[model samples]
Target: MTSIDASKLKLPLQMLLMGSATKLVAPKTKTVFIEDLPPEEVAKHAPEPAGLVNLGNTCYLNSVVQCMRSIPQLRSGLRAYVPPPRSANSLAAGTASSSPLLLSSLRDLFESLDRTTNAVPPSNFVMATKIAFPQFAQTGPRGQPMQQDAEEFYSNLLTVAGGEMRGNCLTAGLTGGQSAASAPTPEELDGAENLADALFGMKMEETLTCDEFSSAETAAAASSDAMDIDNNTALVEPPVTSYDLHRKLVCNIQGGSDASAQVNVNHLSEGIALSLSGKITKHSEILNRDAVWTRTQRIARLPPVIVVQFGRFYWKATPDSQDHAGVKCKVMKPVAFNGTFDVYEFCNEKNSKGLEEVERCSSSGGRRPYRQKAQGRR
Candidate 1:
């Protein structure tokens, strides 16, 4: 190689050589100090609501979950839920049930939806639902997931949620220094501690009266042969009153003899009233024979939230059909409902009085309603 002294070279040549040398080396990246940079004008945007992506034919699951998510109280309650502590004895015994896993999966799903605006794929939730409910795990002939009924799924989901809520309350009570001996019964806990029941349960009173038993003794005795009643059947038998707690109220869409008439809010109300109070023909032990039993139901305790499921699907007589000559059809009636639903008419005396008091306070601007007063930071 020919030895060249760069120091002996001309200034212009040296400058040219230096420029070429600089070109050969990598250029330094521009340093940007966060503080030195101009104040960033980040476009502030409100968080848009996140949605669930359908995992297979899982729109039923998505719809039901979204409906539950719409309830802020339920969401917050589930977030605060603490899973029951697994006993060493139980763990050593065998694998645990998948029931509690549904609640955890649901909580995680809600958290994920809350944290991001992106569409969340509910694969875990779908799997959890399948494990929790076998009915939801039904598949089509091609092995693809089937489209299940949303209403049925909703009921099942609530049932699972209620179970989880009970467990949560039980765990909380135990952890808070409460002993098993002093702990409240399941029925007591339902009204007091179970979050699901507190939100959606309705304590119903059903009074079943035997029509034949209400008649005069002479008339009853005369009609005894016709009704197949025993001659010694009591005429003044007391009405049988029973109580039950229901999570949802079903409203029949089709009512009365008119099938073509459009069902409105008034019709819906009538259907609910009928459901609450209906007549059934059955064998009555009090009458000692088959008779018409009139069942009247009243709401003893009303929940803060009420779910009214419209009975849309029904079996229609189809003479042309080969299978059982009947086909399942959906009533696509446009049900008109008001935003404000007054359940005072359906409430019992005590609940009605409480509602009246609430209305009176609300109208006078004296105090908040019972529901509002009971609401906490959550």
Candidate 2:
């Protein structure tokens, strides 16, 4: 065997060894930072618009948030709100027990949405809301998505927002001459105050009457004496009544084919009418034990904003279920409505004629009718 000298290796073998060594070493890669790109390019590459994480079935919350955001007054008010400072007690609780944190989170969420065109995931807002109101944190059996009523969620949100406003008002009032001196007066604060009132308040009058029967002794005495005494009657005074801004209008869809019949075509107006003149039956707490009928009627005042909630969900008997009770289901029928409607027709008699006169004058003057887009759930 002939041994080859170490320095005398073949050129082809040496070249092959060098190539293998180069293959063993990894090549350097170039780093690209977002800062190095153009502003427009950076925006294009930004993370997809934030969207709500579907933590379980949170569609109910998402829907309510969308609807609430549509209200310009609410949006403006919430935007201007600055949450109160956290307290030591609240800090000890380890979570926000008041509206401050929740409102802050909401403000952050709204800002995020405004900054980005895409819908952001309201994870922080949702968590804050859940902490403030535990009912929203409830889960269905086996950790399933729970279904919630949109109206209920809306009510809860309004309650929180209203509470915050009331608390702020009270604080301002109590801290008299400090910041209250500089605060807007009742006249100057009319805009936000009126908006709040219009969104949540209503005024009404209630008339109550009593029907009583004379006692046996009194009856016998009256009959024996043949005297006309008003002992069996009592004079009742009417009471002032107040109602919430949110109105629930119910539709009886049983045994109907047409849209008008399925849902009372006049539901919106009729509901207002009925609420203005509804009867209440109650047992009197007085010694006479009389039956009382209280009639409610709307006052001359009306709110700037009116929320009408259709009673679409009802409890019905479930077929093929022997042990279970009635199940609640939504009415899936469509109700037709126009772009504009005159609610003046449903106002009290005192206001109805006046509104009619105004309408006639406006129509004769060739002025355009006030057109409002009515929104409803089918």
Candidate 3:
């Protein structure tokens, strides 16, 4: 065989490489359509709300986003976000670019939900979020999509959104909206102390009292001198200091029934308030006491938004098997709730008294019937 010259083969090699590159970089195309309708017709018959396209097992994120969008205030505030500058050499500056990308993508996704007539995929938002938080960018061992806890996702989103809000507030103050004194510091942002106070904060006062018990020697001496001592004599310890904090109220479900139970949100709130008020036998490490009765009461205030989490899952011991010894099963009991209800009964005495008249009138005959609102089901 005749050997080809090296220079003669150079052009063919370059052409081959170019061809491979073209195949690797081919563009993907997607087609989208919108129905044509007159402005009046569109206004009269608004299109159904769009559903989110799940990316992998991202239904958890979609559920949270949908719920957040339902709140007009939060949706509007997020839409009005202004990203901070990324010029500083600090660690915060390093993350500024990625954070803004996630925020902007989220805003865009929300805007699309409002404008689009059909289901919209949040591909850009999901990708940007995954880039910002690498821990969430995980795949299953078998190459299937991984699942995430909805509560954890909600908490992370809140923290990120809170940071952005703090940044925006600081930028506004520096740009002449307010003085630097009014600007929130990084510590405040990290804990979201200010936002928590403004949105879901409540004031609670807790009281603790120590139970009196006679020592063994004192008890024996008292018994010996029982005839000489007065029967009305007794010793008492001072009450413990009252503790106060800004905290959110939590409602816990006590029991589950096989038959479907009608759950009233207001009733659940009342149960929490009542359960928190009673005394509990608690050991005090600081006071070196074996037993102490502690009581918690809601002195005043309630959050603008109340978060209720139903205890619907529990761990149950199953018969020992080869595959597993126990399993965590979800409660299948149906819980019915109304779209809106008054929670005045659960509030403190002062607050409940104020709402009694109004609530009584609105809830005449001890029953307030509510019409079911249409909701999109997955």
Q: Which candidate is the best by lDDT?
A: 1
Q: What is the C-alpha RMSD of each candidate to the true structure, in Å?
A: 12.3, 15.1, 19.4
TM-score of each: 0.70, 0.61, 0.60
Model 3: per-residue Cα lDDT over 78-104, one tens digit each? 555777766666555654457688778
Which segments of candidate 3 are over 4 A away from where they belong?
Answer: 1-47, 88-99, 132-135, 167-197, 202-251, 254-288, 292-299, 315-328, 357-378
lDDT of 3 at 171: 39
What is the lDDT of every predicted structure here? 0.68, 0.54, 0.56
Enumerate clash totals for all models, in the order shown.
0, 5, 0
What does candidate 2's lDDT look like per residue over 240-325, in tens digits?
Answer: 34433433233344323344333343444544454455446565444333354656554343444455565556566767899887
Where's the lowest-lDDT run of ten residues in candidate 2? 247-256
Off-target runs (Cα >4 Å) in candidate 2 are: 1-55, 94-96, 166-195, 206-267, 270-279, 284-287, 290-294, 297-300, 316-326, 349-371, 374-378
TM-score of 3: 0.60
Ranking by TM-score: 1, 2, 3
How would you encode candidate 1's per-residue C-alpha lDDT over 142-220 as one tens digit per residue?
A: 9998888888887888776677776545444333434446644655444545667767788988888876657668445
- In model 1, where do residues sit more than 4 Å from their true spots? 1-48, 85-95, 167-193, 213-234, 255-267, 317-322, 364-378
